[model samples]
Target: MELELRHLRTVRAIADTGSLTKAAAALGLAQPALSAQLRRIEKALGGSLFERDHTGARATPLGELVLERARVVLPAVSELQAEAVRFANATGALDRFRLGGTHGPLLGGLVDRIAAAHPVAPVSTYTAWSVDEIASMVIDGRLDFALIGACGESPPPLAERLTWEVVGVDPVFVMLPEGHELAGEGELELASLADESWANVPGDGCFEECFATACARAGFAPVSVFETDTASVVHLVQVGRAIGLCRATFPPTPGLVTRPLAGAPLSWRHLVGWHPRSPAASAAAVTVTGATRAAYAEAVSRSPSYARWLTSHPRFGTVA
Candidate 1:
């Protein structure tokens, strides 16, 4: 007998459950039937797929290889079936969209635009703090699309698989307490404050490398007095313990003041990325590109931080 989908499914079930009896129960088949299927598959291949031990069934080396291939093949087959069914029902209407992104202030309006554009379509959202995690999820089919920063300062070997499009640009600001000595300065240069203590997020944080790179560009390494992975960097800045950098579009907090970096390369571009081959990804790419453009326009109109940065800086206008 030739290899078939059922044979692959049985192999996966046995590998996952580690017992023929439980695999049969999970598959809604009698133990004898499941055993026969396994035996037939092994015979066709002229080898034993699993080792029967006192405890249960365990996959041999060949069986493990088959299971790995099954994982990729099964998901593709299932998605194809689902896509065909959806096409039949909607006659080519848009289906669900899976999205991932870093947690940043601009995401609020971006999410709003997607919601308004597709009122009835289901959207799945995931927030990733690091670029690698987002890339892995997209490659493994967990996410159809993601919005991420280009990896350079944070880590090496960036998410190189997905196609990326720049959507928005924002300046990095130095967040300080209201009564701090640097608060009086109109624009703070990184070199002017290199001697000051800094507060940083942990290694996997989105801004950690950006902050380090900025300091390095200023010709000095920062002395990180505190390191935590809290969502809000403003909290650390407000306590007067250390100064931190944040995106200019971040909402203003009551006790914090942010000034643009006058000397260092302080701008970061927001990017929209997706797997090239996924049908769902292609659909999401079209919708998000249009929506992000509109959202950037709206942001410039209403957000004071965006208006000031975009109008005064020549490079900011090139985003999107």
Candidate 2:
């Protein structure tokens, strides 16, 4: 809750976008999550940062003061990171691996592969729900690479500045309690769960809107949709509080059953990216992207349901 660079970035984004919803979209955060974060920031700072109404958010006097400082600090920090990376590359000491990613198994799998490939490399990771946040780290030279996902054919963030390679594509799936009536079914029609509540981990892409549109196409709207963390989504599904949506490769969780939505109403694409101008691009861009694709293939091969589904679908799965 302490004042931090990220908080300043949040205030700046809100000020720039003039609306929490728009700022959240730009920052790759859910609107509710961003609002809650703003509330916490206001509490910690002992003042309201912005005047909020249906019209939009407008910065208060205090907000303007913070914005003034953030405008200076954020860019200065970016420059410092750029300089540090330049120094490292010049000295020929750019030997470490730094990665940023959203929540998923693929990041870990890729890390394992990288470690095996370069046993002496000091590898590190940063996790965020926001794809933009991860992408920005790479652009600012704070991280060497970014691993993230987009809904369907949606492109990864800041494509003009970074080189992105496809890892794999996965059909989105629903998680049901093991004893639920649908648990016995191999696949589900989207409309079949019209009355069910939905829960999913927050993501920065169009997946939220995509899900709603798919439900509309299926002829019904969800009764409720809960945007929460991964653990909460699983807990909600396990206790029958809600049905959870996840990547098709979601590992088996006891008391929960994962089933594909028939016709693949929704899908997710995995990608890895790095700033083309950064040392990582020349040093090990191939190594990192290769590890990611290999790791994804290994994951899919181990997922019986996904493997079988991929065989029949053909069009989905590994990008190559």
Candidate 3:
């Protein structure tokens, strides 16, 4: 009959939602099950949290006091966990190489290289769609390094505690179906695809805004944009439903082709970051960054069209 963090969270949920049924739904519990749990919690606390009626549940005075304490306790506990991890990492207590990345080709290559170089050391990876999420994990010591991308000239995650370095740069390319009329061309004008609908993987970055600005400079706003996952973007382009924006190194897909825009109006910058205070800052960062650059080169070599395009555009491709 002791109260726990879960009990506090349940109480807070009931207060926030203002109904037992709503709180149950929010907490992913059956209404009856939530009620039973709440009854036990109330008995432990020696008072009911909410006065319930047909209208809805309303927090009593004791509930308000508990809610206030929960607001403090939850965040404190979270910060403590983060600080503990940071301390462990700073003290060299963590022996494994932990990497977090936004969905891309670089992570796998980097992981492979790290594992090969350090056969006895453990290496793990975490992938997410958002660059900021990956960067935050590095800052919180949940990851030793982060592999992410940013739109051209845009800064990496705003955290000052992390050090970010460019691993490579790539002109954003347009993905079209193999049968597309423009697919045969060496390069396409952004304005040429003015009327075409677009699809791209959704993420937290400046890419979407940069795309819109580039299109505006091309003298036409996109007719439609379907924000979705990478697989869906490929499917949309393959079916001729929409064109997709991708890295120049995007691997060749069976039904799709990627061609650079004539003016290189858009570009992606590959970056690797780590908390300067973490174990990765010693020598692992340099090793991983070098591996990532080499990986980018391999990716470019695999994409024949991109490799040929790089030959013509000397300024683009893997960063020095």
Candidate 4:
């Protein structure tokens, strides 16, 4: 028989209270109206749903079956109502901010800080491989801000139109497998690996262009065989299949090592960009950008390799 949510709620209430008068009172309905609803349900089912007893009213066999189903159905309906209320509260009241960054160190500490600092507002982060796509998202109002790599040779697109902030610079490192021929070398000269197959981040001009130019300055062009933007490029390097170029602040893992390129110039810089037109963009951008720079600084201070790289190359200073 076809039954509605109100019918199930009425049955549960009657079963709980053990009297139609009490059930109607609990449900905030008139006694006659509640009686009519129960009678209509019983008629539809083609059976008597309750038996009159000295104590009060009790369920018949058909009523017991309906009560069992109502026990399951009523609570589910209540829970759905609660969830609707929660969803409405979350999306309707809280301010939302969207931020995009390259697949690198920019997103690491900023995500946690934003969550802790702004408990009420919702923040979203996206990883983009291409600088052009990130710039487009910011310009089109799809993102409040974007954190991207910038180099002295090729900086990010127009900053005058959009408010730009230089968060930090991530030193580029050459990733190589454990026990590889050059793994034991204290430092690498970029020209030596001219013919070696390289793995690169697809559509990310920062790493690919920087590494290629570094190699060209050392007098050779690298042959890149595989291209991907995943953070696991270090894993590919660890397997000895291909060498990778990655940021210095990459998470530490066993069996992998990053060393400074002895002869190459340090040029990689990370910048945070936001559209001036977005109302919530400045505050959100400041929170994320500040956290990101602080994390990079703390991470570098703790890493011996980063320390050595910095000491060896004094000209490469902190980016604004």
Pick by lDDT: which candidate is best? 2
- Give the residue spans of candidate 4 off by over 4 A: 1-94, 204-210, 281-284, 312-317
TM-score per prediction, in order, is: 0.63, 0.73, 0.73, 0.64
Q: Could you give candidate 3's per-residue lDDT for residues 1-320 as a string of tens digits?
A: 88898888999899999999999999999999999998998888889888999999998888888899999998788768877878765548446889899888788888899899888888988999988888877867788889999999988994566899897899999999999999899889999999999999888988989999999999999999999989999999999999999999899899999998998999899998988867888877788889999899999999987888888888888787
lDDT of 2 at 38: 96
- Indicate the TM-score of model 4: 0.64
lDDT of 2: 0.89
> Residue 3 lDDT in model 2?
87
Clashes of each: 0, 0, 0, 0
lDDT of 4 by residue, 147-236 (tens): 787765565765645777776665567788887789888888877778788776776465556666677788987776578655557667
The whole-model lDDT of each prediction reads: 0.71, 0.89, 0.88, 0.72
Over the stretch 202-226, how does candidate 1's per-residue lDDT look in tens digits?
Answer: 4354455666777787899886557
Return whichever of 1 and 3 wins on lDDT. Answer: 3
Give the 10-residue window scoring lowest on summed lDDT in candidate 2.
85-94
Model 1 residue pairs with clashes: none
**TM-score of model number 2:** 0.73
Rank the models by lDDT, top first.
2, 3, 4, 1
Worst 10 residues of 3 by lDDT: 86-95
